[model samples]
Target: MTTSATQRQAAASVKSRPPRIADRLPAEGENGVFTESWFPLCKSSEIAPGEMRGFGFLDGRVVVMRDRQGEVHVLSAYCPHVGADLSVGKVVGDQIQCAFHEWRFNTDGYVAATAIGDPAPKACLFKYPSADKYGVIWAFNGETPWWEIPDFDKPADALAIRVEYDVPIYPIDPWVICANTPDWQHIKIVHKIAFDHKQYRDCLVWNNYSMQGRLDGYYTDNKGGALETKAGIFGTSIFMMQGNIGGRWIGVMTPFGIPKPGHTSTYFILATEKGDGSPADQQIVDQTLAGLYHLAKVQVGEDKPILRTIKYAPGYLTASDAMLAKYLKLVREFPRSHAGGEYIR
Candidate 1:
């Protein structure tokens, strides 16, 4: 018997539903949502010339290093030759020499030179596209060609301040912190701040509703006259806030997952630019960083325990989770082959 076209279509639809095992498995685009874009990976200072830094990103292990020429290169940390970590290897000229057998790979991750008695490796280490901008290094893992990478550049006139620190919460997916900025109720409950307080309460409420309304604009409302706003791509958001209280203070938060599954982290930086002729400008910048660090410890540190303990279920969502809903929607709609996965673990 021949199946009709309608019957074939129905069969195809059924095949597309995620399998039962997928309940615990994050959607392709859901876990490490990868789009045709650039996500900041690290500060320029973090990877110095002739230095190799191992990083866990996009659910996989990647190594970032600068050659003697001072150019940056990113590649899979695992050596394709023997599964050795490339980070332990040293940079010889433009090639990375593997520590195990001294096998060298060029900036493009192609096998450049193999030591004696070594058979030509079947495959070369995977190379990730990377670029430098705004004094930061960005890595791309999308399936599309490198030419398709998105341009991520900040304005030259914009006051830039860069701050870096390691959060103690490891293995706790970074999206939790990334999503926290848009989560309104948490600020009051977790941070234990009076949501009704004039400056604090008003700004929180505005940011919460603004994000819900999907308004793509800057928001600057704080006791210190700081402005914090974010931009969204697909369902992910990049936060940028700057305020000129005593001096110009800027903050940026970008979230990314590892190349594999089961890992995520956010890269946060705060920069304070000194204003001209402002006698108190330097002090203001210093105070701002100090104040922000304290706030981060209280707000982010407190959320760590709660977020880590909560059971994660992909489809388990609530009406109050507006940002979560938007995030999931973006995951469902975008290509996930390389994008970060869903917010849920």
Candidate 2:
């Protein structure tokens, strides 16, 4: 059948339409197969020496353990033999001893010995590259870490830090939440931060895995206090900022975790410079950090409602959205993988 001129014109118009945001952005295969980024597994103090704990990680499960020598290791949770949960197992010397079969696996995740007294088989668990830093245990997504764990510009011991791992969980991808950093409009409108837009636009730094922005302004609270801010998002999951807020020096690091697809848990690391080793000075530092943490929570409360309900389609982006636009681009090209496979379960 031959098409009419009008019919041909309609088909041509349809083909010329721009693709949707989903199509435009690079696709990450599945929710479980996440981008190659550092994921905060648990607090360092939670897993004491000679203790093992299982956590629901990325798409599956992992065990964080501390050997007798005080070395920390994060390996896939279930045992290679009989699928016993290693978290319930005991730590023997520098190895993991399975509770069910008495099989022993070392920090390298290879079976050190078998309960039956026979030579151990060639089975091994997936040992995730992990680091204990900033009072948290972090694991990288792929076999090797893309970059070092995020840290403040100042030395850690010089700062008084309070890490809150039980912050509210967001029912969304971690990247979606991290988009907050580059979202200038959201910062200005929702968080009440006022800064010179032209200066900020000129001074913003963009890199492959991170973005940093500086703002000098005042918080539009009733008092209109002076504020100078420096903020950055690293690896699509960790958001960190340090600056003077209302004449107080504060630093914050929030790294997100994925228990599974469509769910994210946030960790808050609040810090300020430590004072002189005196009772009065300690009290002042404590109060300053406490107040800083409270402000962090308040900001989270402000963003919670909108983030929870956002469909997040960038249909009509404006100039104010340039930073968010860059973040989305970084997410598109970021590496992704289900690194541990079935052993993580």
Candidate 3:
């Protein structure tokens, strides 16, 4: 057969297959930085008052420090003077004192003092927009954050929050993991979640920076129970779920971090409403949170096999995949920047 006829025969024979597409969505557009989203660096407990720790971030590094006054700060890791890793230094009062020359740097990323007594050179560290929330320390990629970290409807003080951070890093882009939120099929198949018969267009409420929907049904897994979940995927790196499990209120917040390209770190924030200030009430609240934590672990465990190996391309999507399609579009349009490159290096 001729080349054209052979091509026609191949097309006619193929029934269904993954469509040709990009490997993964664009994380860094023309700007050469990960999407402008809040990235969790480490747990708040890791950096105690008057302590500092360094972490690998999007194509760079950062140091997290808590001052003597118990305020947390995130800044570029390397010192301007002779390029020392500031995390090796000591936290002196509100400033970080570089171990090399004992150069003291303030939270604003400017040189505060130098042990050598020379006029402190006009040097500065890249101070990332940082926050301590959901039991994790987070830093935004851009100079200013587009939005704050999301919270449950109730005030934080009204809730009991427990954070778990021992999860293994996944060999996938952060956004690819966030895609699981709208992947209804995976929800039903992997996590045994059976949602009521409602389409994405009917349930999803999309916004500029987030999308949320409610799923109501029972887990089809052997240990079945009723599930009423309201979940949101925010800024390509955070997921929040408020739900009723076993007739009790449960809340989960999962934030993803990119240690570098093709790798993701995660934290689990499990929460429940506070009860009356009685020992018995506290015990009940504790048990509820423990159950929620176990559930979160089980669901994530189910996802590990696929996420670690997925070379994500939307491929042959159907009408049922409308939610995933919408999410991908938002990810592409999301802002990106490498503003900290100069200093974080």
Best by lDDT: 3
Query: Candidates 1 and 3: which is better by TM-score?
Result: 3
Task: Report the alpha-carbon TM-score of model 3 versus the true structure.
Answer: 0.92
Q: Distance (Å) between predicted and true CA of 302, model 3?
A: 0.7
- lDDT per residue, candidate 3, 1-345, as tens digits? 999999988887785655576545774423467788998999898988989999999888899999887888889999999899998888888889999999999988899988989999999999999999878999998989988788887789998999998468998878888989888888888888777636544788888789888867788884438878788898989999887877888889999998876789989988899999799999999988888888888888889999988888877788888788889989988888888988877
**Model 1: per-residue lDDT, tens digit, 1-345?**
357988988899999977543223243245435444455566778887888887766656678889887888877788876678888888877788899988988887778778885765656666666776546676765534343222223443443455454444344344434455445556546655333223332333222112222212221323233223322331232444333322333443443433343444444555545455365875676676676655545545677787767544455455656655555444334344653222111
Candidate 1 runs further than 4 Å off: 1-42, 117-122, 133-136, 145-160, 187-238, 242-249, 254-260, 277-280, 314-323, 338-345
Candidate 1, which ten residues in sequence have the lowest lDDT sum? 208-217
| TM agreement with the true structure for every prediction | 0.66, 0.90, 0.92
Q: Identify the superior model by TM-score, candidate 2 or candidate 3.
A: 3
> Against the true structure, what is every candidate's RMSD?
11.0, 4.3, 3.0
- Give the per-residue lDDT of model 2 (tens digit) for 49-78: 989899988768999999877778999999
**Candidates by lDDT, descending order:** 3, 2, 1
How many clashing pairs per prediction, in order?
Answer: 30, 0, 0
Assess the local accuracy of residue 40 in candidate 3 as a C-alpha lDDT between 0 and 100. Answer: 95
Could you tell which candidate, 1 or 2, scores higher by TM-score?
Answer: 2
Displacement of residue 244 (Cα, Å) in model 2 is 1.4
